[model samples]
Target chain A: MNEREPGIDRRQLLKGSLALGMASLLTPRVLRANDSSTVTLPFERGRRPLVAFPQKRPLMVMTTRPPQLETPFHIFNEDIFTPNDAFFVRWHLANIPREIDINTFRLTIRGRVKQSLTLGLHELQTQFEQVEIAAVCQCAGNSRGFFQPRVPGGQWGNGAMGNANWKGVRLRDLLQRAGIERDAVQVRFDGLDQPVAQATPDFRKSMSLPDALQAEMLVAHSMNGEALPLLNGFPLRLVVPGWYATYWVKMLNDIEVLNQADQNFWTSQAYRLPANPCHCVDPGDALTDTVPIGKMPVRSFITSLENGGTIPGGERCTIKGIAFDQGHGIDRVLFSVDGGQQWQSARLGKDFGDFSFRPWEAQFIPKPGHTYALQSLAINRIGESQRFGARWNPSGYLRNVVESVKIHAS
Target chain B: MIPVWMFLLLLVGATGFAWGSPANGNDREQGSILNLPADPISFQPGPGNDLASRYCLMCHSAEYVYTQPPHPREHWIEIVNKMNASFGCPISDEDMTPLVDYLVTQNSLQPSPSAQHVQRDDLKETPGQSSTQSGDPQKGKTLYGRHCVTCHGPDGKGDGPIGQALVPPAANLTLLGKQSDQTILDTLRNGRPGTAMPAWKNDLNALELNHLLSFLRTLSP
Candidate 1:
């Protein structure tokens, strides 16, 4: 990733989804540093022989505490569903709570609903059906650090996104019970993410009327089958499936239904993307337009051995990696065993539920002495394939380029 | 000190239990507060801290900082120089000696230890089997493809796609055995500690790190 600070270009809608991937397996706890901190080691170390499980270790993306850095960008998880211990955290304010008493905490859901309701964690669990999905939560600016020219935000790499098996009550269900007013046009979620301006504190976001009603939307309180990891927007968070995690509000203290869309800077002025279809605008022409980045375009990469790989003859190889598009799933994965010359469509494994990731594979029989060049490309049902570059957006939002690999048979 | 607005806002928000309010979690999180006394936390640096967590972990993690294996002096300088130039670390020329001293000593694996100090860690690093068992070879193959191949070439021979990104061009893994296991471990874990090599602890688990190490050992001359 080039490390030049290219100031924000007014060109495309600023919908640039970049998370400067500064890594470290940090959770919210990392940001909520109180006077002194310590960790009590896991008592059952003997039961866990290696205390260190270092297989397929994912790299960490680092981001600093705000005041130390600003939001719009921050540290991110190397993986899509960041591990609880390693979720990148970024907030605009310096004063953050070290801990919020669960007993005293509450998630208020109010707005244009038939009935205004107050719900408790246990009540939430007992009353509604618990639905879980492994979806990725990515900041709007995930990978902003890689913007050929730098921007003034948390310079993230690819780590801000994280996948999680979120469990919680459905937002749709809650809205229905609240009796969403007949005229309500949008639903807003204001987090405990510290209101930027106290005088009029405004750090709010909302989903459209239809999205708020979708079944995939959730008011989650748990991650990875455990109580929500604290740094992961614990107490409560919004998990929006298949969408950028920016909408996944953490420490959600308020959920309000409104008759109109939120007009706060967070929405109206921020997260906006170009409404045009200019993927590869000339640098000169690129200097003018800007737009909001939204709905991550379809993209995939072969996570298995990178572009240049070498294996002894007749080696059985398992090709692995992940792919993502706005809504449509992975249609087919094509492999180019004989370099990028000829192509063969490899079999994609079973589909993991709706939005969760499914591991795909391709087995190849190798020959000795000569090296093989392999590359993989994914296409959705609509038949759109991942490209080498999504075209240079000044913000460098989506780069779902196809990944290639080189293999040698000794 | 508690900000009035924060405390007041929270109090009102918490107790305002209206006619229909959501339930509070009541989840007793004992270890929630960072292990610190009742005081405000600041991102300030400390004195004689010797490799403070802030300076090192800003880019890596504490887990990476603590468990690192040690390295020889020259290799350490190569790392320090890299971080200062490549990764944007502000390592002053003055801080070099002490920083290196702390790392080389605290993280040092004494070839001259009191022999009785043999720990299990020593056992694991002693040139284990050749099967690439530390991590899922399948996973490593992919990770290598994604990360390692960028510099180590397609076949661990040091010619990679991102190889050009490295100023000195990436290290030739097949030849890392010249250094001891501790040196190799320390470098990988701490990322040359303060250099561009980046402490890799956050990205790799010990096993995965071990497997990558195993793979690199195979690349040695």
Candidate 2:
């Protein structure tokens, strides 16, 4: 059996074991603000001894008011389905619903429809076909904290993502009842979330009319076979499989069908990406034309071993992790143990659909006195692979670079 | 390697990891109550500190200003104007300058140290040439005040009234120090595309452009 030395500082361990090519692999656990100057580092590590709030387990708190919480990296190693309480929380506005009355809650479907229907919470659950899907909901800014020349926005670690079994009615079913008008050009979504100041833009987003009618889209009320957590949008949240979390509106109350394209701030200005293939450009390069951030790219994370953790030398060890992509599905996952000079395929775990996280495992026998530089690369069915380096954008969206981690073998 | 029993325990004991699973979660009327945490963030004191508190603090926390990557004074002006124009903050034209001044003092952006190594040169119009003593700094300062201060800010931080109205906003002049002198000259002659900056080829003579470039160099923190 392998044993680790007790109480080795993770920072000192990283300082000792960080390889020449693995500089990007290591970061401070948390970027603490200096007391006098109040300055924080560009990137931050996860907060330990997690802070608990509401129905949530101790999560890494990014902000308290709107409640931006991040999942701890270690929890990814536990199960394929991220627990509801452990899931991350992100809110664009400050006035999030504190107390939701189930009896009075109504989901109003109006605008550009023949019949406008407002359904209560009970009717929303029992009236439609109950379906369950295991999908991943990841923020567009999942790894924004790691960005070099870091941009302005919520600086987040990899924990801003989770895979859960979502249970609800198909959005198509709800739209059918409302009878969408032929002139409808787009479908807009709004939630109970509102800004404190009237000047601040309301949190609203829209999908093209055709895209909104897709069969996979859902109005999820239950996560992981249980009622949605208060922080995770208790009453209902839209589940747009394979899309970023921004498109998945939580605490949903209004579904308006627009005859013309949406001109809202969230759609017209924010969450936009450069038209480039990787959406990357040099720092300060002008992005004149842009498009909305849509489907996510291929990504993988080695969660089984903690960064700078130690392993027993001359003994075989199993490297386990998870890989995912947009609903195109994960084609294969490759592990690189020698700074990406070579790669070998890892064994795939159970199939949980294209939108769900797919776990993988590989065996490695460490050589004594050598530091193992480990990396995982995932490719989707469309042959899209994770980039070796992270890209930059003004909004800091859709960062899907291949992840690297290192461990010492003593 | 992990023992088979431990592996089995991982799969079987998955639910145990959840600290508190609510009782009667399936009950329809037993609604979940979420109490949002109080706002614990406040702004740091700097120049025009009261203006920042009066205008900016009304909408969001001070974390927004403190967390931004350090930018030039002109950039702060654009941001302030955006707050006024886009978000409808009631800061008048007089208060705008001081608010921007405060933001510029606070923003001492340091690029990620690790990221400095891979900095790309291909993005610039002209590469490799450093600053040269072609323009007079005194003349440049005068030219900046007359032609540029309204948009690029008096300090060239891009915090001008018109700059904030632009879609992409004005470029922070302080960051231009890393560019070749020729690149800065060309950008002035041929304004950036997909932005509000316009070509100044006809607006200023070559000597005046050089003078403005020299003055911009002084704005670098």
Candidate 3:
């Protein structure tokens, strides 16, 4: 079991050294006010710098204070399980915990329970039946940059999502230990992060008691078989499988079982989607009804060949990518080399789990000097496929539009 | 060869030391600490730029404002009011107009070309001569120290304290001596798309930009 540690450590070290060498070589000696190195996304004002944070390789920087770092799209093609260092990081509040004492850290279960209990890291690890599952944790605004007519939040590209094998004790076991009362209605989670102002609502989220008791819900202390990074919530965090990352509260320290519904700002006001079947509304239309953003919709991506990339002409080339949905599992991935006109089945790769990124590949022979529009459509077991065009909304959430990449055969 | 039990004992010892033992009574050894890098970008100079720095930076960084898509005046007003009303930003009624005005000036979409030209004409009294004369590099250096040094670094190596944390990082200006003045001037006027670089069209006039460009030339080897 421990044999893989040396291999993973060596590989990471080599990658880190190579990346540093390339950065030094490509960096110019002279700098100007307007001359910062940048990678431009395929949208207006999409130029972003690549910065490295602790325990992470160079990733796209969206904000500096709360540190919303996005993984590069190329990392998706590397492996089915995203390396813990390469996983994306997002925090809502600025004053996040920079230090955590594992020995002193405690997971408190209180409110509406038969008994309040606080479990230390060692107790939580040893007393419960340890379980492991591979799941995809994605931000609700993963592809907000692609939204036409634009939106006003973090303008991220398609790099704000990642899949990983999470290891932890089940939340159900912890709730059972605390003994839920008959009046329990909801389970609210609070993290170590705090708002700058007292009046500003603290970052908190809740789910129905039934939803929280799902067997898949975990109070994870380890990610990808290692202690969670401080930025990704070190001591402990909640892992809500198949749900948006917003509900997977990082640096989780408190779990309060409430007798009534949660009316916090993050619950009632923020992260709301239009309450429609499509979760969409006409652009510029006022939202009459809204609901808290939940389960991620079906999505897919072509990770191997990027837009405007060149492929070998008059030869067979293997096109590869990843496909995933909010659990039901990807039924079949349809590949179109002619921009959705012709559809061909791509062979699906090994299954990690229902809540994991399933790899898929297809073969294509391109004619020399021909430009082809490549697209992938992921259909789940429930027959939910990606929309041909992007859905519009004021907040720009849940954009699972059929992604098209225009590439030329060399 | 070491016995298997002996090896296991050594492994347990190492693990305990690495994570810290409660018996040691050293709190510092038990927890891990991380020091995040500083931020370099700030709001562009305008009527209420100071107010924005005072109030907004209390909760988030300036990139939150700089990164937004160019919105209309109404959008800026709505966001500001939301921060005050919902997020509890402490802007008073008197400071509201100036704060919104500053935001609109820096981040709002540009007017039509004809109207823009008219505004430009109004700002510059001697627009014709401003382009003809070269600027003083010494004067440019002072301006660079004030604005460019934050992200570009004092030596123009893009190693500024805050620039270290930026994605794609701040540009290394020392290698740009070979580039033409027009290219640099154009970038200064229009700004690079999707980058933290903001256009100096409203902040700096043509002559001041030329001075900044002259100072930038000195960064090249």
Relative to the unseen true structure, what is the Cα RMSD of model 2? 18.4
**Least accurate 10 contiguous residues by lDDT in model 2 chain A:** A21-30
Which numbered prediction scores highest in lDDT against the true structure? 3
| Candidate 2 lDDT by residue in tens digits, A238-304 | 9999999999999899999999989998998878899888787787788888998898888999989
For residue A128, model 1's alpha carbon misses the true position, in angstroms, by 2.3
Compared with the true structure, what per-residue lDDT tens digits does model 1 show for residues A330-383?
787788777578777777765755465544667777889877767778787788
- Candidate 1 local lDDT, residue A359: 48
Q: lDDT tens digits, residues B138-163, model 1?
A: 55666566445645687776665434
lDDT of 2 by residue, B68-169 (tens): 657566557767877787666668878888888878877654322212211221222222233447678899888777656756787687877655543345
- Comparing 1 with 3 on DockQ, the higher-scoring candidate is 3
Query: Over the stretch B1-221, how does candidate 3's per-residue lDDT look in tens digits?
Result: 65543343333222211222122232322154443433434566667876675456556666677667777787788889988888876677888989888888876542222234335435532322433148778888998886677567999998765445344456899988766676576556544422334444545677788788888887888
Candidate 2: misplaced stretches above 4 Å?
A: A1-49, B1-24, B28-33, B65-81, B104-221
Question: What is the alpha-carbon RMSD of candidate 1 to the true structure?
Answer: 21.5
The chain A TM-scores for the candidates, taken one by one, are: 0.74, 0.89, 0.91
User: Between candidates 2 and 3, which one is better according to DockQ?
Assistant: 3
lDDT of 3 by residue, A79-131 (tens): 88887667888988776765687868888999999999999999998999999
Per-candidate interface DockQ score: 0.03, 0.10, 0.14
lDDT of each: 0.51, 0.72, 0.75
